[model samples]
Target: MPKTTETTLEINLSALTHNYSYLKSKLESNTNFLAVVKAFAYGSDSVAVAKHLEALGVDYFAVAYTSEGFVLREAGIKTPILVLHPQPTNFKTLIDHCLEPSIYSFKVLDEFISTASHCKQQDYPIHLKFNTGLNRLGFRASDCNNIVEKLKATAAVKAKSIFSHLAASEDLNEKEFTLHQISTFRAVAKNLESLIGYKPWLHMCNTSGVIHYPEAHFDMVRCGIGLYGFGNSANEDQNLNPVASLKSVISQIHKIKPNETVGYNRAFMAEGHQKTATIPIGHADGISRQYGNKQGFVFIKGLKAPIIGNVCMDMIMVDVTNIECSEGDEVIIFDGIHKASTLAESANTISYEILTAISQRVKRKFLK
Candidate 1:
């Protein structure tokens, strides 16, 4: 990858391929793999990522909203797309785009069925999401019979898959709880199958679940963060490569005197003569305010430059008193060697939050 002339998020499809292959290596040959591309593929480029994954023979794609699935369809993605949290208002549009919805509640299910029927749809694919343990979404085990009955009575929508979200699959300490969620999902699926006389393909594992719980890799597994690189643990992270590299060039260099402060609120008072380099990336670019006042650092000339003072909307000044560098030199916020997980740790956050919080305004350059 060339040095970014501007604040840019360079996406490496080759890295993505490596991560995908690594995650897939853990699964059975027959197990389907679903790539979650929601939130702009975790603040990269969804279209580029999805197109690459589709070409790589991905089994399915998932997004948080129907509009995201529609975007994929518009991009000529032929693979099946599941709208993980679809709305009733968009049911007709979802059908128009041929996107599947994860019907989590009775209200959503009933509304989707009505919309599907109104649209004169027959056997439109839909997923049943059960609230096994992740109380965020999905139906309860007790609702299985009702769900099965609803499916039996509706020709408008067909159950393509039954799935649930794993709340703590990444934490080995919660292994018992995760196993219980899996078992509950299994019981619900079996009971639903018995009532419906057919089995919809089952899935409940997220990226962490895929890594820690092979036995719970029901019929499919959803790989989100793993697909973009961080594996939820240091040991697993070593096996994966980060796909996004946030880079910028030093916009300006400042020379400060003793007792002189930097940025708004005069946050950083120079103890002595110090050099500060301003990079054209800040909270607007997803480098949050939490990273200000020496909380975060950037790599310049292979050396660490601590961020000084408050983070501006479009700029941040970093202390470069020791590093010998010049204007136009490359600065690495995070890359394959220094992963986003590392930077995320500095701000007391997780890699997912850091990765997905990246603003869309930043230029995206892809390496295929």
Candidate 2:
């Protein structure tokens, strides 16, 4: 048996595979599935998630940095890893590990080319990123000339894939805007292809785009949050199984008198006589401090327990007055039943924030 901790992060691999297959079914057979495993696989466990996705025959894996890609390489992951935000400082390490970098800006492209040449590397695969509309990291669509010029001039670097990110693929209200972005990307891609005399694998849609605009399934689709089984909108199908569950044991229970205060700075005041359960989890464990003051809740004995006071670095007090729970009983912060969405909503955030915000200090337990 695996060693038990005060708090447990349960990763359901079967659910992951199911989610992958679910997204795969939505795309054409020719469309490659690229799994985004950055942020430690959305703060679950990148190595495990990447391994599972690799075993499930995912065509590619993407991470935010070279270090994340290195982790997969060390784990013997043979799948191509695209570094979404590759830095020049890590260019050597990235080349050493056979990791591909996404050339977002001209500066990054030059740095990568220079580094690869210094290392005596030849024709290293690299993905080109177009900004489209995200306003984040990516080359501007109008700047295709510069990209094409560089690629044509440089024989040391090779274009593996060309891609862009959708800003709001899930919002139907933004459908018109999304379409414009898609059109722009398509035009830029066509121009680049014509200029380069070759068609690099083109991908643009994210998880939300894959569901809402299936036609945008270009050459590949990147799925991140969806892989953990949460749709972009509640209106979409809810068949995707949630892959992660968080459970923490109540370490202490106390009966507070009316008008008593709880936690640091007395953020939560008792309405009446209440029983409070202190759990061994707090912001330090990924639960945010914004969830303090009874705004956030957890499941105890199938009942809602309002979190009281400030979510400290190491613990959180819950108003468990009516719940039939004990010191050693498990409390569900987020699971299939509670839904990570519910928690994020309570904290005025999205499920992505809640799931990815989970701290690294907590233990991860994988369930196949």
Best by TM-score: 1
lDDT per residue as tens, model 2, 293-351: 87899998889998989999999999988988788888899988789998899988999
lDDT of 1: 0.93
lDDT of 1 by residue, 1-368 (tens): 45679998989999999999999999999999999999999999899999999999999999999999989999999999999999899998999998999999999999999999999999998899999877899898999778888888989988889999999988999999998998998899999888888778999899899888899898999999999998999999999989999999999999999999999999999999999999999998999999999888899999999899999999999999999999999999999987899888998999998899889999999887
lDDT for position 365 in model 2 = 91
Which residue window of length 10 is worst by lDDT in model 1? 1-10
Per-prediction backbone clash count: 0, 1
Cα RMSD (angstroms) for every candidate in the order listed = 0.9, 1.5
Error of 2 at 42 (Å): 0.6
Model 1 TM-score is: 0.99
Per-candidate TM-scores read 0.99, 0.97
Candidate 2, superposed: residue stretches over 4 Å from native = 1-5
